[model samples]
Target: MKNKLTRIICTTLAFGFLALPSAQAAESEFSLDRLVITALRAEMKDLDTPASVTVRTGEELKATGALTVADALQFIEGINMYSQGPYGQSAGRMSSEIVIRGAKKGTLVMVNGAPVNMNGLFQLDNILLENVEKVEVIRGAGSVMYGSEAFGGVINIITKKQVDNSISSSIGSFGRHSHSLNLQAGKLAFSGSLVEGGETGNVTSTSTKYTNYTGSEKISLNGAYRFTDKLVMNYTHSKDDINKEDISLSTNNRQQYSNDQESVDRFSFQYQDDTLLANVYGAFREIDYYTRNNDGSVPLPTMGGYPRKADVHTNLKTAKYGLDTNKQWEVRNNKYLAGITLETEKYEQNKVIMTKASAPASPVITNQQTGPFERNVIALYTQATHQIDDERKIILGVRGQKTEAEQGKEYTQLLPQLQYNEKIGESSSWFVNIGKAFRLPTLTEMYVTSDRFTGNPNLKPQSGWSYETGWKKQIATGAVKATYFVLDMNDYIETDSTAAKMYQNFDQYRNQGLEVSWEDKLSDKFSYTVGGVVSNPQAYYNRNWSRLYSRVQGTLGLHYTLDKVSANLSANYITDRANDAPPAFPVSLTVNYKAQPETTVFATVRNVLNRHDVTTESTPSSMSGYFYGAPRTIEIGVKHSF
Candidate 1:
């Protein structure tokens, strides 16, 4: 089977390139002028960063019918998704526990230059993707600029700034449909979208076979005014709401409803001159979520019966302010860039859960409020980039952070980073980076106490030291890049499941991995990319090492265009994995297609051979199993712009 799969993949790549000539010519057209300045506080080319990164453009997203950020990122290397089921009951509950270079969740996610840390849980759903202009993902620790919860890496969503007026809509199987509109005039831009979908098992063999519905609405507006050629001011606002119905087969055939709403407002000022550039930004955000579960056997209080119900609510509010400045100077034949940044963030979370009884006779009640928690963090950082001669460059960076909790614990950290880039040839470069990063426990991780889990007030911070090296080559045909990285983590925070719920403590672990990718245009009409990643992740406790570590992932893509029609096909695979513990079945072969630049259709036969794949097992004995990848379903949708 392995040999056959390999042969098929190779055949597809060869055929895809043989059909494209224009694509081959466009591959060699490289100019630095197309690059845009990013607020990531770093000066980097698309190919220069010493980490694994992937960028998805707005056009590519529309072509693939990607309704969410996670959907669009599904094809990227080293990324995966988990869900309990399909539709509303399990809708927003899907876990995007992004694992980059073997680092799991706890990664930092940002939107429009602001941190969207909803209690250290990255749940910015794909509904937000409708208003996104681009996405930049960096794999590995990035605490120098982002601070806490960056131990895994960073995902930045850049919202759209409309250049013109446009509207798009689509409808498809399983009661799926959507519509969107964008408008821009002068210095102002506004956009809005609505999506509604439902599923009933009758349509396909893979359908979840339950009544499920999901609806979402979102809006964003931004404006910029130039005070002078070197100065500008900008303001932006965004809001989103999502509602879903839950359908689960395991527990008494109960139905549930979940709703999530978020709003963000931000303002920024920028100034630039021949040798200096500075930016200041301030932002505020609020997020709220509510869920209600109802089992069939439970009767309403007015009906004189017991009510088997659960209600959970959470609210989060955050304020952030920051400033950054950069200066450039030249001496002899060398040039240098020095920059410094200061930022602070205050975050709070309030949660409540309740259970009730049907009136008449039975009387029942449950604790409603889980203790509220708040945390504040402040950080200052600096970085310097020096060009030594023309073939070699060096970067030195460091950050100092102070964190305060409402419970009276104060924590501080000093992290440093060093990197070097050497031009091996006119078209090739080699780069290496060594850095230290840390992550503080989340508010819930520190104070929340519930029937499902327990919080640990004494839990120490988790720290990681990582070393990375890579090579990038841009040839006449296309581009090739490869990287090798290893991380040694101390005081790793993991849950202990021996108790009824779970506890937290310091656990040691190590992650080592390699990634390689190649993209080439065989001809003007054909282009292809092949990439793969392999890693060994393990845990250590009480002076003993556990062997759970080994994962292999890979991808191959092909594209062809003829006049007004364009076609794309790609397949991704992940081998069975283990962490010196039990082995999980492999997940392989997800294929997607886009016909005509505006229409996308996909079919993913997860666990192709119908294998039971266990992707994640939480420390508390709560396990998430993917028993047969989504049952082989077909998704078709069309989009139009005017």
Candidate 2:
């Protein structure tokens, strides 16, 4: 590993040297507009953000065939997907979740700047990435700006706005395909897309073989109309349905049926002029999950089986209304920003479970449940950027939020954040930030109950403090960024691991890490990027039980463009992880691909060596069930645009 890393460093430096003369000659053509601007609220240059941020553009997404957000995020550094399979499946221990800088998926996900997390269940599918124009990732705590559940990081998905009339389509492996269209005219714009796909294969579990079938379909619409110069209206709607048949975990020979349906609608009004800006928006989302499991003869005493059947269904609905107001003013020789926001969310979940077994036995169990939860949060925040001198600036901000949960139980928290940026020279700058963040227990974690899992109503909120410092250098030919960060969490909430597992609050953890990255346009036809991260995380529970956390990962990538053709190859490696235990089998990999512009001719391969490494581990009891990485599969496809 060391030798490979050394060779990579040398090759990168050599390329930079070879391209220096041309870079200097073309310096006059360089413009800030060519650089991507992330939606980090401050509108700072991507290289100047206090936290590590990565931007993946729509063009890149198309070239990579990234049908989901998880797929798109695979090339980024320090991000990993824990899923049952390549296609998103609810079972098999691999949840459709993303781990960022070693933090779990409960991290905040935002669309445009509004929270989209439903009832603390991050149900966002990568299908949304189809219409995504760009994604902005903040690699550390952002609760000061985004509210609770921003403990690890924030991923903001910015959807495409019509800039021109266009249509595109493609068909690929696993019976997958997609179509999209966009139209723009003056102040009126509209876009729509459809995605349909399916999978059929033989799946094996515990030495038992079963046929699996999975399919999904989605439709979306977005439009914007300008009523006047100061006010505009925008609307969006989306619906998705998925169904599958697969083998069960406990009964490896028995087959089960599962289905999911989700829908979302959003409307917003924006008024802006000069120094004042305001936005008011309303959003609604619903998700439904249904499952049917089969039990064969020879009823087990523990499970109460023999010709048994179980049906489980869950429904969730959320309504959110929020308003944001921001005003900019000058104080002394600096600019100051003041903002106030009010948001209210009403959430409800209904679960029904029924079971019947044995021709002669009556219904053994039946459950009809309703869980209602509501939260009202109001926040006032103020921030100021002071120019202390020609090369130094400081940002000070504070936010206070009052939250009311179910039964009018209220909680309030005061979070303060500070950042400093200093220009060391014409080509270098340094930045540092310190802030606090918190996460409230999810409704599922508080009140939901079933034969498999139980909830705790007395769960307490988790809070943490995070700090990071980094330096960025834009040299004559490339840019380099490196940061070190640490997080100390208290009152962490995790499932209890005793004999009869239940929800508990006797866990605390600490995560610390380093991230280093370099990107260079070695030449007009060739550009490359490389990044690496190392993290050390540990968890402590029951006062004396301590263990290393799972998901310490790393990544490297290279991108080259020649005329109308481009190629990108990325390699990701993750060390073995543990949950309150010791290290297990680590996941390591090298994925590579290339694409041609306008031809739809693409070739790619994953797990080139066919390494059967487990990418994740189960929590609580620390079971070692494994998820198989793709075994050297190759894909070829064509795409067209009009």
Candidate 2, 572-638: lDDT as tens digits: 6656566433332221121122243323455554443444444444454544344443333445544
Q: Model 2: clashing residue pairs?
A: 68-126, 69-126, 600-638, 600-639
Residue range 246-328, candidate 1, lDDT tens digits: 56555535376667777767777778887887878777767777777656664532223544333667676666677766677
Which residue segments of model 2 deviate by more than 4 Å? 1-40, 88-95, 126-130, 185-188, 200-213, 224-236, 248-252, 272-274, 296-310, 357-367, 544-551, 579-639
Error of 2 at 456 (Å): 2.2
Error of 1 at 293 (Å): 4.9
Tell how far residue 520 is off in model 1, in angstroms. Answer: 1.1
lDDT of each: 0.59, 0.63
What are the RMSDs of all candidates, in order? 5.8, 6.1
